[model samples]
Target chain A: MSAALDAAPGRELPVLAVVGVGLIGGSFAAALRRAGKVGKVIGAGRSRDALVRAKGLGLIDEAVALEDAARQADIIVLATPVGAIPAILSRLLPFLKPDALLTDVGSTKADVVKAARSALGDRSECFVPGHPIAGAEKTGPEAASADLFVGRTVVLTPLEENTEQCRTLAIDLWKACGARVVLMEPDAHDAALASVSHVPHFLASVFMAQVSGADDADLRLSLAGSGFRDFTRISAGSAEMWQDIFMANRDAVLQELKAFRALLEQTESALAQGDARELHELLERAAVARRFWGSRSGHE
Target chain B: MSAALDAAPGRELPVLAVVGVGLIGGSFAAALRRAGKVGKVIGAGRSRDALVRAKGLGLIDEAVALEDAARQADIIVLATPVGAIPAILSRLLPFLKPDALLTDVGSTKADVVKAARSALGDRSECFVPGHPIAGAEKTGPEAASADLFVGRTVVLTPLEENTEQCRTLAIDLWKACGARVVLMEPDAHDAALASVSHVPHFLASVFMAQVSGADDADLRLSLAGSGFRDFTRISAGSAEMWQDIFMANRDAVLQELKAFRALLEQTESALAQGDARELHELLERAAVARRFWGSRSGHE
Candidate 1:
């Protein structure tokens, strides 16, 4: 309902189990704890060492097995790679508490939505497919921060079978963690994210590949300034993580990439034709749009 | 010559006239004045109000007519747009004193070299073409910083006819302003710059165009974060300036753009085919290259 209507105000809140206690999951645990919105946080992952580290860092109150945590957790937060989400959801389903509120922080929504539909079945109303549009190049539990999602957007893709109370509980939890929550259809979430996130990452990688593919790449890099640094910065992110994202959001990403390629071809044609006015007009439109967007996003 | 081979030291240096006192030109005047390497710095531009403002900010010791300043200046720095450089050279040729050394701050090299060859003729020995790989989204005299080129690379493309003394003078001046000068052939400079700088600008603009082309662009932009901010930052730069750069280095930029397009196609196909391994490998190569380049360039 409202921000004043806390997820569980004036009561000992539910235990929130964060599976795959890395950046996203760890940050969720830390932020919830920092906000005094949870009674306990459990870390579940394949790596015992990482889970122990997360516990030591107070990102989680304790490290536990996923099945054990799923049986006891009042809420289950699946924060893993997109490709890994479906498998993890299947595993958690058998042990999950009937009243548990399940949510995931994945870049792609469609695949996760499908996973919830297949795995949760009659209990799908408790599962919410979500994506928090916030992260840094560096990852892991050690890199997690309580304010990672503050002032950031978190999109929730609720299924038609989801109960209104389940949806409101998810939103209130995210709000308590200091994020601005927005609702969208699964396909809509994927498309919007493809434009703003997935496609941009691919473009950065493509541009980086072009420069490195050159014979004198080192020489070209030597002359690179802030422009090159900022432009290709995202290309240095984890390749494995991005590969999964590309595959999970394939159709939307492909469509946006096609649009991007078309614009690039048009720009290249203008340059080849020595059409200064045409090139200027194209750049001018992009510049104006970017400026307007940046101003709205407090980037200006 | 070493940086110790000062352009002017211990004695009051000759009058330095900065034609087209905008960002590049204005910064030159400011850095030289800060180093106390000149007796007086004169501002020359078509905009008298800007010239007066430059003088008021002490970016120039005085504001003067271009022809009048050219007649008396010992060193003339052309800081105009690339498209305007040739015409400016033509105008300066008749009024240029034999001993006056001429240099320009243009982004592209080949066109400026051709202009110098055609306009200077036998006097080409006194001209040097340079490109300082330093700038910001902001422009004009007000945005000029004395340390703009400090620790930055400034490539000098001296004509074959350039005298040793003339070349040394240009290097000395740039060195005195704290720029690390690198020698390059005009064509080589353009090609290298296209890979590192020019193509990246176009790519940013193209990506921006793609995002904004969507009907729900505002919603998409609301989800845009730091990665988008950094990736498309260059797209916010002055359109008129970039248009000139794209046109001046048309052939080289087109070549780089083609390479970039091919890479994008490869990446797109990998995603379309759900070839995770191929996508991962491509991204891995790009990530490795970007990390290596970033480390060398202090971007890491």
Candidate 2:
């Protein structure tokens, strides 16, 4: 029945195969199944334990080995770490069919796009690189849920070599998952995300490190509340993942760091003068700017 | 009626005069009134309009001029900007009765303590400086609600010279308002909050400035979601208030900013080298530390 249907249509919901069934991958499986967009969803990973659990939990329809899963599937979703993307693509490249749509959900895009293009032979054009700008520090398959993408932005960084069908299919899949999709070239996307995403992680970490080094660290911790907790929350996420993001987008991150340093100097000078009004004015600008922006965003 | 009952010893609930009928001040008044702890809640502020409205909304039993309110009330709460504390206290000093409990809901305790010492004639010992870590970005009397302090912390900074009754009475008032009272010294509270609260605002503002400066600021604003918005939420607070906070705790703010810069450099170098293990290891520490500290403070 499926074979005849596939032969008849323009795009019969492709057999969606997911590799690395962690948070992003598991979420992808759940979203696909819940939306009823894909014909069938398959899970592939090195962990047989995870695969059995994934199938049992109905996170995917069937569990298959990685290489076999890639060869048989019509669309491949790689939701592994940025560092792991190259190796995962390399392993699956020799087996991928021509029409298969290959994509990823890594935070950064340029490096992943390069790796996918090089590893997938002519199927590079079939590759659609993506980043779901949605997360929590909490990870693993147990944390996966179907409605995670609601009201989140899923950014797609399609390369020069990416085919029109690749971009369209990826957009349709994310839209079905209840995400707002935005497109950019891989390099531009990587640059913007480094400033918006990766830099924030490092800044929060440094703030934590300062407090940890304090003589009254224990006291401050007890006194810390929602504002401080929210500010430092992401500092608790995967260090390795953060490191990859920082390294991947070093130039942009450094540029942002410099800007923060200058602001600090100006604030320090203001304090030294005991010029309360002048200091207040500077902080007022920052405060007003943030408040105004939040108002404009409709969330305040 | 209130004075006649108050003169009869423990028969009358002490009156609390909140000096500003904005969100925090109004909420504090409402909470005290709701709990039935105070015999009378009077408001004293420059905004006759807000005071009249606060009375209409039943936030206060009376809206009197600052001096008139100070002459009658047993407690005076300076619930305004840190910069205005000195001037506000100077005006209220002549009207305050002998042994009246003077306190504030200022964010910075050190500055307030200094201002109180300089402003009050003899009963500086009656002054108990405090910060109730309960408020919303929403301001004015209209946004005031009684439940704003239900589960938040109220940190009191009692100087060594401050009387025990002053401390006890302050804590009692906060407890009546349903706040968890945390006691600390003025300098320590200022320094500690500088690390936890003031520094986070600077980090967010500096980071946001770059993004807001971008040619596509509007586009970025639209694409941002709950997490990004949540993380940067406090940046939208009153600039005048934040300016005072940052300026008052300038040294601590600068030190924290420097530490962040160094940490970013380290993270940048690590990312440039693609050191996923080292990066992840650091981030893992930050996540665990933040969770442990943040959760304890009721921030998570």
lDDT of 2 by residue, B35-68 (tens): 7766688998878998899899988889888888
Report lDDT per candidate: 0.85, 0.76
Question: DockQ, per-model, please?
Answer: 0.77, 0.50
| Alpha-carbon deviation at B215 in model 1, angstroms | 2.2
- Which structure among the candidates has the greatest lDDT? 1
For model 1, the local distance difference test gives: 0.85
The digit string of per-residue lDDT tens for model 1 on B1-300 reads 322233445644777899888888999988887877666888887778879878888888888877888787888999888888778788888898767888999899999888888887888888889999898566889989899989899999998888888888889889989999999999999999999999889989988987888789888999888889989999999898789888888889888887888878877887888888889999999999999988887776
Interface RMSD of each: 1.2, 2.6
Which residue pairs collide, candidate 2? A236-B287, A239-B279, A239-B280, A240-B280, A247-B271
Which candidate has the highest DockQ of all? 1
Given candidate 2, what's the lDDT at residue B171?
83
Assign candidate 2 its CAPRI class. Answer: medium
Per-residue lDDT of candidate 1, residues A159-255 (tens digit): 8988787787889789978999999999998999899888889989988988898889878989998899989999999998899888888999999
